[model samples]
Target: MNTIDLQVPHVIWWKDPALRNLYLAMPVLMLAATINGYDGSLLNGLQTMDSWQNYFGNPSGSRLGLFTAIMNLGGFSALPFAPYIADFFGRRIGTALGIMIMILGIILQVAPGVTSNMFIGGRFLVGFGSNISIGAAPLLIMELAYPQHRGKLTTLYNTLWYVGSIIAAWTVYGTIKYSGSVAWRVPVALQALMPFIQLIGVFFLPESPRWLCSKGRYTEAMAILVKYHANGNPDSDFVLAEFAEIQETLRLERESAKLGWAIFLKTPGNRRRLLLIVLTSFFSQCSGNGLVSYYLHDILSSVGITNTTDQSLFNGGLQIWSWLVSICFSVCLVDRLGRKTLFLIAGVGMLVTFSIWTGCSAAYSQTGNTGAGSAVLAMIFLFYGVAGFAWPGLTVGYSSEILPYGIRAKGLSLCLGITALSGVLNQYVNPIGLAHLAWKFYFVYIVILVIEVLCIWFLFVETKGPTLEEIGRLFDGHETQYVESEEDKA
Candidate 1:
């Protein structure tokens, strides 16, 4: 086989009942990303509700920023501890723990006549818990998926963000017909649904086999591989090859793994991995999508679309469009096109759309031209359509895939942490910028998007056609040495 060929083996997962069951259980983890998407769109939707604005004092400036930024702060607070839980307790337990905390947050959010303090507190817990689960989910999904299916399964993991967004957008749109607090409370209370589903679905999931191997439970690890990857046949060639590959890779990793945070900086390969992780996480949040994801109401009002119904309709429509675009690319193109290609496409596409968006916003501001305002609306959808290609698919999965087993959980935690911190800054600054500078604020993202494209071109490597364990060779070169046994050599 040519080394760069991206084609995966043609295994029909549904033909094998065990593999079928394994795939069915994936939603337990995928919903972690969904929770985050729902939270973002839910806030955007609530800001448009009259009763919500009246109840909350129509928070603007720093106060409104806090309403949006607190969640990321809460998620950041949990980052340092989340990986420890994931690494020590097991991925399944870590996920369940996060969901349980998030449910507590929903209870606080839905309490009758909830005070601002209590609501903020609830948002904090929800962010905190959601980050913990999000930190663990991609790692487990990649580790558990059959090698041929791993890329699609892992990439598709975050794409479900749009699924949650779609639900929140339309839910908010539907509830807008009511004229009371129920308009907002209904949407906020529904945040609990995904976590509840996750809590139940998680019980049915198998523990990550690589994690079991790391803990010296070799028998248990092999048993899972045998059952799911090879339909209960321990003697099957597929099962035997996979088991040997995992054992060999894990042995090499333990020998070279670094201690503490040194793992991110101990060597050149580790340094490259750290750079990619930080840049990827930062770009995912700061690349102008934050403006739309959390503050579509503000954007619409600035353009004279003050009617609540029109704003809700546009928000709902955008989510549906985003979901469709994300689903197509993640399932069909992520593997075939490779990581770097899709990322470059996203960067360049966002740059073009956002530049036009900025120009139209300026024209609308200066002349009050409804046509320019209309153009700005079209640009918003184009921007996200371009963004959906990579942000929803690659952000978490690409970062997770590049790290070796020793630091997978910890590295992912750092990725999410950086993402939260970047989000904090963007959420706080965006409203302030829009209030003061209006369209001028968009130029910042235009500049950042240019840098994003350059970085993707120069720094990002193609991580196609390798197993999770084997991909390290692209970074470490001769440092990640694997010996082929005679049975494998044949």
Candidate 2:
């Protein structure tokens, strides 16, 4: 089989004779994903604890819903500004700054005598801090990885998110049983450690080569790329070609408009790309995954698992299995199945599962029938394994690759901003649905799923195995025809 030449320039230099730096960098980046995931999901288990009520003064009905919703609200509030920060300061700086904010947020939550207002304020800070990682990580990973291995490497970040969720579930389950305000604070407070560690560790890593090149620091960017790609036969012409491509891409971007908000809105094709990306991100959140992850215990209670211990254990175990399944599937098929196909399949599967789930929930609520309700609940979780886990992991990877290099960070930030907003709405509405109309709540998810399917089928494009240049062409509407080539096979 013919190997597709990567076309990198020869002037780039690696740290050593081999490309070990690139391999080492993967773990560091993945660690960022893991911590981000863990903290994001940690709240899942803590919601049921007595400390939850203590911190929030026994919030009931609509108030309880608002309390839960406020977590996402914090995130949404900061998202619009995340892009500007990332663009103006650089991806690494934006990420570090966000983590620092998260450290403050966690401290407030853990301190003694924190009122509900304080708890909300603290969580809002956490949400704001957390968005930086989600917004920046995908772009960083994409710029760093080789085209052939990009999908698999980027999915590692998503897999770690599930790992974080599982950890949160188990940590809260174990700690909540011990009896004290610490039960909840301990789990919530632990999130502080992640950002602190990330902040310190990130300083040691190099800035993104793409971002570096964007800023006209071509020599430094080339050096970092060399370190990552050194294992490729240095004698081969592939390196020079790749470097030329990067240079050309950067030149085109700079000549176009310097990659600012003006460029984002002025370019017609870019505007469309931004819209699709935002829609996909919004649908991903509104699909009710957030609702399920945040309110699993309540959902179980509606189906008859009223015991707190049983609920915690069951919910925790489900998260574990979901994470495990997502990792397995992401590692195996993300490259093979491609982004568009997996999304369509997952969307349809979720629609079916949630539809059944909605009916089962309604039945259980009306007739007090646990048997059918239990079965539907099980299916809802199974759907999570198939749909929830796969979609998020792949969505970030796909979104990162689809936009042109010039607008990559801004486009990602815009998409993520929508994600943050939708997530806040989902979180806010989840408690309300659980409190007021338990069975009817999932109907919102079902509606979102339908919209997701329609949008994906109509607007989404297949981005598997394309070089950044080819992807840019697709985005520009200049390349409507796709020609299969040997490089695409990898």
Candidate 3:
């Protein structure tokens, strides 16, 4: 069997002036993702702060969990619509609209004397706004970036997301002693500023050339690509090559028939790819990272750390470690190990962690031994840091690469919508389960992880270094067909 060597295309870098331009774009993308992360985490960190309890009237257990979950519920609820808006209107437009919604959420969250209903409404709007960026950012970045650096660059979103969480943890930790409700409200409101900054920044930046080309705006696409390439001359060979590729992709797409919601379901290969991507997303959310990140303080407190300062320190430390570990994994192993290996490793790690946590909880409940329980909880936290960062980076990389260009946006949107719904379920259900059953919640995670492991082994194909065309062929089981066609052409 002849095998096509699957490796990432090499791009001109370092001496290449465009590398600097790409680096400059990183901070802006990071800032956008940071706000996204901060908004997601602010509520959880705030719940541990004394001012938050006072403002909300000292809610405990399930009620606090419910409050935390509400934001995710709102965000998830709005995600399904994000794809349509993004596909139809373009990613820049989608991102701007999302920012606007977030600003409304910030107002509701920070406004004095706002009713709970008002707060929920604001959060829902914020969620709606977040859906736009979350759905669009990867697509925008993937389309804008050179293929060689796309994985590393796109990882910026997740990295910045964690940075935002870190900021939230430390911010709440530092401000807990300050007077006024600003401790919590300030962080929530700070999120509103990011979108405005990003909105302005985006104006200076180029739109996705792919989107422009899809709309038959070749001149605009070529101009954007020239800027992206920064190769002095607009007619450079690289620029011409890229334009030709875009034209060919567009021609094939137009010839193949319009890809829409109905055809997505009716097509076998597309349906399979959609199911795989969505399931991967769903399991990633359900793997318990969301619960752990949002409820670390509660979980630590349950293990017997009563002092708020101590809990904050523990959470902050955990976030730092997780971020570091994730960065290491993403840099060294993401491309090397391929998607399947990472998911397999992550699933096994989750299963082990959840089992240990369950055992610790059972032992603590039976003997009332806080010390043993604490040790076990510490192990669980360590497991969380490692798996939390790895799975998401892998999942995002996998989802972005697996589909054909024609259906990439719609397929990703559908997958992300399922992910969003999973986020809602995770936000709502995990808290309820934790409140009623506490450590037994590990059993639920364990079950989910086992299923994830099986699904990956049986269903997912290796996509380590294949081109988009080759990867698409794998999904369609057309590799043999393509090989024979190449022979005929030869």
Candidate 4:
């Protein structure tokens, strides 16, 4: 019945050049999120661009829906193996491989004519690569980030999603001016640009020191730990303590069981963590985000706004708005507000938006009022701002943090794997529903978000101001690990 006052980080930002340099890798990983976001938003953005449709043979109704939803299938298929790739070969290798695969996908997508075979294949590869890059990047970021600033840094991955989404939206929006096949081809081709930079950039950055330690590359891990955490002072208490904790966590995992699926299931503390992870991830997608993310144009067209220009404008603006709001949310609120509080508060706002969208869409369905449909249309931005603040990067960030080092990669993979699979359902089913059920599809999410809010309120714990190793203690019967400094309490 007592209060939980989340404390601030112990680290000072401006004074620490070493921490700043370590945080540098974050933007690189962000590009991974951007690509993932762009891909998710791309088909819809391009779908709104007639030039794209014309070259791609203007897929409509079911075929168009399949193309959009198909990417999730790619993500789903890759999730199970992605963890293994990341864990076995290493996070950097996994990220590099994902980028390379995505590049191949980009090449195939720009082919002339409908090129349906290439289209599906290209999109599938993009999905596969994105899941790998997106999944691996966050783990690297979380592993490397100083514990005090980890939450804020890790959640920014989601904000980068909007960065990618906005770039795609504007790329398509701007390039919509081009005529014939060139219009769509140029934008689609442009997709290769940033990720290519990221593909090259990953090599310059340090590997996750924790991952290095787990593999018995202690010398390399110690070098990275001192460089980042201790500001080149190997003897610094913070660096020594953090390095020891990482070693301890790895030792515990090694003693308990060999790394595999069973470790996650067998441990009671880990079992609870895994359960919450699945539930959190399930809520992330099922909250009806896909309805807007993948099919905003479709939703708009339902209201009789058939013009490509208007659709592109609205979608572009929404991406920008979502990006800005999420960036602000991650930078300002994530650490300050803490994870659970924001999720709960923002869930209420999302609930309001969804309920209104359903009512408005339903009324437009029956009344055929342009105003009613427009009201539903405007709600998408409100929904973006609210949901962006609540779940976005924080959900996955929290999922990764709660896990023990033994199964951390696999656990994070499991969480995202479920989210990706759930997205497949959203992508596949929603198109069919939008085609047939129209506004009624909103009702399903309305019910879902209500449950999502309840779950957050009852289940989620405050995760701010704790080291990842310390957080592990909260779940396991292990002795209190990585306790925050007293200065952090102030």
Best TM-score goes to which candidate? 1
The CA-based lDDT of model 4 is what? 0.78
**Descending-TM-score candidate ranking:** 1, 4, 3, 2
TM-score of each: 0.94, 0.88, 0.90, 0.91
Off by over 4 Å in 1: 1-10, 252-258, 481-490
Per-prediction tally of clashes: 0, 11, 1, 0
Displacement of the residue 89 alpha carbon in candidate 2, Å: 3.7
What is the overall TM-score of model 4 with all chains considered together? 0.91
Ranking of all candidate structures by their lDDT, best first: 1, 4, 3, 2
Q: TM-score: which is higher, 2 or 4?
A: 4
Which digits, one per residue and each the tens of the lDDT, describe model 1 over residues 333-422? 998989889999899999999999999999999999999999999999999988878987898889988987767788899988999889
Candidate 3 clash pair list: 75-127
Residue range 292-362, candidate 2, lDDT tens digits: 66777677778887777777787777777777777777666777887777788788888888888888888
| Model 1 worst lDDT run, 10 consecutive residues | 1-10
Kindly report the root-mean-square deviation of model 2 from the true structure over all alpha carbons: 5.7
- Which ranges of candidate 3 are over 4 A from the true structure? 1-9, 60-66, 233-235, 255-259, 479-490
lDDT of 3 by residue, 1-490 (tens): 2323334336666666865676576565455566646754576677777777777787666666567666667666765577777777887787777777788787987788976667767877776677676677677877878777666666645666667777877777777677878777777776776677877776566778888988888889898778666445696777777777777666555533453565556556766777788888798678877776677666776777768787777767776776777788754676788767777777777778777777887787778898767876677676765585456665656776776666666666666567667777777777778888887777888888888879888998887776676777787665421112333346
Worst 10 residues of 2 by lDDT: 479-488
